[model samples]
Target: MKFLSSLVVLLLLFSCQPQKNASDYEADLIIYGGTSAAITAAVQAKKMGKTVIIVSPDTHLGGLSSGGLGYTDTGNKSVIGGLAREFYHRVYMHYQTDSAWKWQKKDEYGNKGQGTPAMDGENRTMWIFEPHVAEQVFEGFSKENELEIHRNEWLDRESGVTKENGKITQIKTLSGKTYSGKVFIDATYEGDLLAAAGVSYHVGRESNATYGEKWNGVQVGVFQHKHYFNVNISPYVIADDPASGLLPEISTNPPGENGEGDKRLQAYNYRMALSRHPDNRVPFAKPENYDPARYELLARVYAAGRDDTFEKYDPIPNLKTDTNNHGPFSTDYIGKNYAYPEASYEERKDILQEHIDYQKGLMYYLANDPKVPAEVREEMAQWGLAKDEFTDNGNWPHQIYVREARRMIGAYVMTEHDVLGAKTVPEPVGMGSYSLDSHNAQRFVTAEGFVQNEGDIGVHPENPYSISYGTLVPKKEECTNLIVPVCVSSSHTAFGSIRMEPVFMILGQSAAAAASLAIDQGIPVQELSYADLKVVLDEEKQILTQEK
Candidate 1:
């Protein structure tokens, strides 16, 4: 009897181990990318009683949310609820402990965050935190939910995705690992998996007429940020000597007419984590390929008596600031990132290295160069990269902020009208209240012989508007069991508003819930009832409608 009982137990234990599919590992759901949305989606899948795995190319998880963008770009806190809000609440919980404030006392850090109370005593949500704290919180989410993430796994774009009957059956990574699932979610910033799976997507700006948007395409006359050259700065390499040709960063082509369509994308930069604390700062080191000549324009701008470089040095916890591109000729490598959207991996690496060199050189120039003003140089010398952040990349940010990438053109593309709350979204999965914001796309010489920056716009939406469920799923004919949360379907102008980190998290949870429901009903993701999805989301505390 004892031998028979042992045999039965051994058979059951072997059966419980996951049986590998002929293709790769099999699960109920497979998630791609390592963005914050990707993490949240995997967690939601785990909660929905599904076996899920994350196959990501990123060495570090939580894209910009953990990559030195500590100052939350939260438009309205009320609209952020559910697991997204839970994330912020967890950030608060981490700081509530006495030991969490290592460098500074919690009482002294008086950051009434985003013009509102950063510490909501009632809601227990913290709007502001450090990069490492945010990353730790996200990692905790992964551990508590038993979420499996296979980092550093790149998807082979060419022959990776295996589809059958208009659905992704299995996906192969460059490392030869494969994942088969009943449902899939593409949460990447680049929409690599979506495009590989044959889903239609759009890159760069669309014409205003294409979506009846006032701020969709090449914006020449409209200027919102202080990133434009104010004075009449000459565009020539030798400062008004036309025969010497244009400067290194300035483009020779025309910026095109207003409202014209173009393939140019917004500038990309690293959201730096600079610290004033001496113990926690690593002084800026010049890159191996640093060229001081690259910053000639910024020097000229400073020479013209523009000292607003410190305007965007917004402070976060532990005496660190989320240093962003402030003035014209700042760290925004304009017109250089146009090829990034469709560039090959090698080409993309080159582009990313260029940005890093440019930004790092900018810091060294501001701190140590003789051309910088003495007072400004002295002030900048006090700031350096935070010692405890992004240690894998020499204390710099691991991820460059890819503000916009390939947006899927799914069954319903949310337009500017939807952004401005002029039209109603059919099914409410999330809400975005941030401004329709895009950084400069191209920097060129105007007809007046002055260097100017183009493609920056900031139009505030009227209220927190709902995001649609259709935007998450592809067209019924395109794919049946896939959902895209990060690279959602929307026009360029509308995506500007919908691309906030909080909104991405909200959409991630909603997409996972939809995926679970589709699996339960044994139907396509697009065929899953929005009414049923809403009930699940509501139970999970997702604020589909705007909060009062």
Candidate 2:
């Protein structure tokens, strides 16, 4: 009788206490991505005294910034401010130490950059660095801020998002984990969370007419870059034979009207980090699906006397090169990633593997194939994947260069006129000055029976233009508390200029500021006053407009 009375008293005491769920996963701000923007956004949110959590689909942080694109595309570096500029300053500080330069001395690099010195002492910024160094800096930012990151957590796109009166209450991942937050920021390259949340976005190019833009649509003959085929190459398997089928990778469909819209996406590739130093180089291994016939057109390109294979082997800090797409058939896998934006996770993995196989096979063929020119092959043979970078991913970059993806149709759509500074941007939050640079969308057989690359446009903006705060805000009716920075509201032409790593970081910080302010004032992101947002942004040292 005594033991039963004690047990009943214990049960009653436990029931009266508050229940705590270990799996609650609640926070003040929830950021979805592992890009450079994600890092900056989380840092800004945490700085504003918000309990923030980063749910990243990527195993590695820093996106392309650490994934072999160490050569920063910084236009008018003076306009770069806030956390974005701080990131570059951190790179400069890292290189100042003797231990940072392992393979080569700092003096040998000669401070080469995109029309500016790679390492500027006066400005205290470094524009070029190694992939591992970039990753270290980004990781340092997270560690210093004590930010919590859940890596490799992919969103369950089908039914993960739970909305209460147009605002996201919480999101669930594929692992059956749920995260609740007052505000959410989608900073992914693919805009995965934004799309899963039923936000309206565009998948491909908007017609010039759709946005009153000059460089938005099908650019069949506008070959501004060296990516187009300079020499006339026949598209048929048997040269000039109509009955013969088209060559591999050459689309049979028409290249489309000059300025009309299409669902084509720009090329995608891994910005390879290669080293010629024998001690740190790993030879390119042939892929399991290697086919010599796949590169027959490349051999033909060699026959046409184009030896510009190493044109874009831009040097970085540690005797390594950030090798990007150069010639007509170098690296950008044209016409291959059209479905990546809207693809399921499993389907996207398959597409990613295909791209990996294609690029890996290309490197092996270029270095080993007898059909390639002896000089070209010998030069290529000297270069191989960097042994020290991407240590976990077989020395290959983990993140593929996703130049463009789903762009949100949000509070305001930035068009070409805005990018060119013809129409003034209202409520400025950041600035971008890079040219409208788009890679080829298709390698198709032209009407003249010649193979040609289309949809490569490079139109420079007249001046550094301000980006409006509206670009980051979703339509109030769609979702009030959500903010998107990486895939902001912009047309294809405008995105070309805004899609830089520095610009993404800038907008990310701005987004978090708006989110923090909205949460504090109990207002939607769209309804937050620009005056209040600008005051905070100015205090944070963000360059919102061109300085007089």
Candidate 3:
């Protein structure tokens, strides 16, 4: 009788305690990353009558779109199609209302540089906007389509992502919750999901020799911007001083046998939220472990009458500026983030905090440091965190603009020739037109002892060009079931142009559509015919080609 009671109690306790290893949820498609691409994918899946869920590590929905990249870098707006176009259209709708501009009137805002408005009665694309408004638009999409979202869910990449016969079976989160899906899309900027799934990817720049391409690796002789102004003034203690212990930020290695590539990666920084509203603004706080010597070069630059240093603090909608790192020794924490692409989560968190500290410290140095020019300090003091934005995280941006990361080694790689109109892709799904722009990846002193920044390209595409569908798919042997819309296969130069938020959203929708079709046809994603894919894309109003 005692044994019988004990067994019964154990069985009842197990039943009521929740199934230990059972999956609590299932979806037709599971997308990792809460980027603009991830949201678009979820919405597209819903439109296709398939169940989908977005599991994002970020608490916010849209990545950089809602982060602080309010000034859009769209190359050719006409080529943007499908849900990507719809997102911008929704932005237009939001601004169409008289109440949209609570702080400023429409005429007062004026059409500064966003080109002529769209003629179809929609307020032409307001490429620039406040971060909160963009977030509302993404949230609106989720509400309208009833998207299932689990924010702040980081994927366990190693043993967490399970596969069977080249298809993803389930993905486990760091919190021990498991999500099962029929198909998966890695809509993350870092390509964490794809990497965890054992997909082949490349980090850093591929040498020009490897791809037979013009611009791939360390470009030494190219001086594009005034970033390295007066490179003669060394950051070290003594002029031409290798003995003064290498300038604080300058790399020590030879700049890699000129066209030969190394594992160096581009700098990453937060798109800080700043406001002129005195009531809501918090002055830039001096970071802990602050060192004044690190900014000595900047002080010298300003003292040399470099008054145009503040020119790149470009204004956005809410009386805030999307201040980016310009000039040498600016906001970019040069040479501190080489391992970010593949670092563990805890390590990434440390990297992010370090970047935050660096940027904040830079702002503080500019605004309050006695060494800064009075005029520059006063101007810098006028800006602070916007009172009405990013309320949950103390008014700082939640997402760091990860400009470049892992580029998948997939079936097709988009190259500069494709973007420059020198070549055309047959399996077109989307298009991009942003200038071939790459931020300085490394800072080094020339043999003549002049400071120089390499890997900054700003060439405009010959015209708008098609983005091939093949760029989004992995090889069949690697992962037949996965599609990477965010970190698609592309040359480092080509990705610079394709890395815009709108383009990512457009690609996300197209990838989801392909995934749905593949599931319906019982075929691998790579095996889906372009004819069938094109038909669906057309029916859904995805702009695939330029007329004329």
lDDT of model 1, residue 487: 91
Q: Write the per-residue lDDT of candidate 3 for residues 1-548, one digit (tens) a residue.
A: 99999999999998898564664668889999999999999998998999998998988989999998876777677788888878877877787888876656666664443344322244355676778888999999999999999988989976889999998889999888898888899999999988999888888888888877677788887766666655357646675566877656677766876677777777787777678767767888777878777777788777666777677666665467677778867887767788898999999999999888878878888888899989888888788878788999988899988999898989899988888788878799888888887777888777777667777667787678889999999999988889999999998888889999989998999999999999898889999999999998999888888854
Worst 10 residues of 2 by lDDT: 18-27
If candidate 3 were superposed on the true structure by all CA atoms, what would the RMSD be? 4.0
Could you tell me the TM-score of candidate 2? Answer: 0.97
Compute each candidate's TM-score over C-alphas.
0.95, 0.97, 0.93
Candidate with top TM-score is 2
> Which parts of model 1 have CA positions greater than 4 angstroms off?
1-23
Q: How much lDDT does each candidate structure score?
A: 0.88, 0.92, 0.83
Candidate 3: stretches off by over 4 Å: 1-23, 114-123
What lDDT score is found at residue 216 in candidate 2?
A: 87
The positional error of residue 67 in candidate 1, measured at the CA in angstroms, is: 0.9
For every candidate in turn, the CA RMSD to the true structure comes to 3.3, 2.0, 4.0
